[model samples]
Target: MAEPILKWAGGKRQLLDELYARFPASYGRYHEPFVGGGALFFDLEPADAAINDANPRLIGFYERVRDEPEALIERLEAFDDPDADPDPSLPYHEETARGRDVESYYYQQRARFNRRPYEGAFDPLEEAALLLYLNRTCYNGLYRENADGGFNVPAGRYANPDWVQRDRIRRASDVLAEAAIRNDDFAYVLDAADPGDLVYFDPPYEPMSATASFNEYSADGFDREDQRRLLDVASELDEAGVRVVLSNSGVMYEPYADAGFRVETEDATRAINSDPDSRDAVDEIVATNVPPEDRGSAGQRELSGF
Candidate 1:
């Protein structure tokens, strides 16, 4: 299966089995609004998909992959070349990794990325290349933005890092051709989804405890209010006869239960945690409106073992 190129915090790579188990056996278009690290989207590789995120650079990168795979690959190749001539405009980091200094290289790219005018014309290839580089080299592959709307994750020291996966990139690009990617609020799915369509909401999880809050991913952080709003949207979709599945903190599933949604719990280890000792498995919830019996033929057989 094609995989996400960027290392996204709260990415759902490990929970794929649980998600697949609960997914409707058959459905129409697939919609994922908080498509971070798109573990589900790429794994499913649905023929018709509407994937979106609030991050513009991310959307632009996906667009480049879908419309300009060759160009994106070429730019990534250039970034991967350690001996390639350096441009004066882009600075390299002082710290050396794998016999190469990349601290300045990372910062320079980060600065340039933040400098790009949001509404102005810019090269999509550059945006894609920088995002890939930062994601690969940044701390735990986390994509945390500052309140000023700048990429601020520190560089991760890796003697030998896997910076480029050309085949994977090409594969993702090919799969993305069947998707409609957008940079919009999660609610945008409301207008895009129809009855029988499946919508998967993977919003930033509501903190399960006082010390576990990692909700400040985007500049406009997702809070409890946003969680309630999302529930409202999911209810609307559920009432409209649309298939809706979602993942969030296990504790947060209480709200889903209260709303009359089916909730299942799974244990997931956080991939981006800085403290190794604190990386133990935590409870995550997979709530859906599609019951096992109504999961169509495929879901029926797949869920039979349960």
Candidate 2:
């Protein structure tokens, strides 16, 4: 299966099996309203899919990957090209003892990305490439934006990171060829979805505690109001005969349960945790309108005899 192009903070890479089991056996169209990283979407690779995200630049990156894979790969190659004379503008964090000014190079690229020209010189293609590079090399591979919608992530210290994922990008492009990319609110799925289709809602998770909030993948943090609004949307989709499946933090237990859906908690991997020892697994709530009988046990099949 093709991998996700970006390393999104709350990405659903670890929940793939749980998600697939609960998915409708058959559906007309696939919709991911909050398509961050889209690990499951890449795994499923539905032919007629519509994926949207609040991050306009992320959406643009997907569009670029789908339409201009060659161009994207070319730029990535330029970023990874060690043989070529290093451009004074772009930064390459060298791992060897002959170390370059790592922080200086990374922040410089970050500034260039934030101050990208809209029309004349620096094109959208370059901007998209920079986004990929930044996400790959940034601290913990986390894509966190500042209040001004600027990309404000520090550089990661890696010996030799796969900064240029040429094959991965090519594979992702092939998969996204079938998907319609969008840059809009998650509510856009309501109008785009039809009966017999499927919509998976993986919104910014409800924080477990006031101090534990990590929903700032974008500038505008997802609040409790947004969470409630999403639940309403899910209910509307359920009523319209569209299959609805959602994943959120454990704090959403009451709300999702009250909405008359099958709610189950599964241990999922959290890739970006400050406490290194605490990065194993956390209980995440998975609520879906897919009938209990229809949904299979992802874990049961793994047993030698079941």
Candidate 3:
């Protein structure tokens, strides 16, 4: 089954075509070092692929979907009725808004999320439902943490945001079932790559402009050192004949170019910060190891069955 198309923050659904255009006609296997949303993974539909993330909960959700898709689907489908009332019984809003002692509050919500019955707590079918819920309903969809390593984002503005994409989740699970899911630091997956493997890196953007940064995807911040390490990995992969595509804030391309990667820039608009004022245009870059000759000359390229 084809992977379901999902709407997720940092998802590359919009750039799938553009990224695919740069991929070679064929590759031995696919690898994603930081598979945040799995947008590119599902889009490419590689027969054999390795998808890894540092977030254990996120990866566990993916594994659950793959192993018990029916249960997950049933949980998500319960939210489908248009007239269903939002679960106001929960104190997620009040607890999240009073952010003074946010760590406790955030974990309380996480505990609530983890403890609820399959129907009330979380829907198994829509693996994305919990992700989307925490993303939209939580502080800023900004997966952040306090000094103690607890999620600390405040509640968001969406009163009853739609949290389930039943069919899409099913599809995404289908795709995930065939791929290997790993929960580890990015290096472990990158090191596992073989010659001709394709790796796509979507690390947190290094905030360039005053208003254009969101480097706090996890409690452990991805700093400049991490960025440099990623570049080094890309270089090592290139030397090993592995194709690498990296997306990041456009400001870092000069360093990447210095590392011998061919950099291509594009303008991208995203709604990131919870504030409406923060949702504006931004420039992003796609640095690649694929040879220029192999890239599509025109529109987005389709690389799945190539």
Residues 19-70 of candidate 3: C-alpha lDDT, one tens digit per residue: 7778777778889878876767766667899988876557767787678766
**Model 2 lDDT per residue over 1-306, tens place:** 577778777777777778878977677899999998887787777888999998877888999999999999888777742223335655343321223243455655565576532122346798898898888777878888777667777777666767678877898899999789999888888888999888999998887778878887888888989998999999999998989999999878788899898899989878788676988877799999999676545421121100
**Winner on lDDT (1 vs 3):** 1
lDDT, residue 252, candidate 1: 80
Itemize residue pairs with steric clashes in candidate 2. none
- lDDT by residue for model 1 over 80-142, one digit each (tens)? 433233456453344222233444566555555655442244567887878887788776778
lDDT computed for candidate 2: 0.78
| Ranking of all predicted structures according to TM-score, beginning with the best and ending with the worst | 1, 2, 3
What's model 3's lDDT at 302?
A: 44
**Model 3: per-residue Cα lDDT at residue 34:** 85
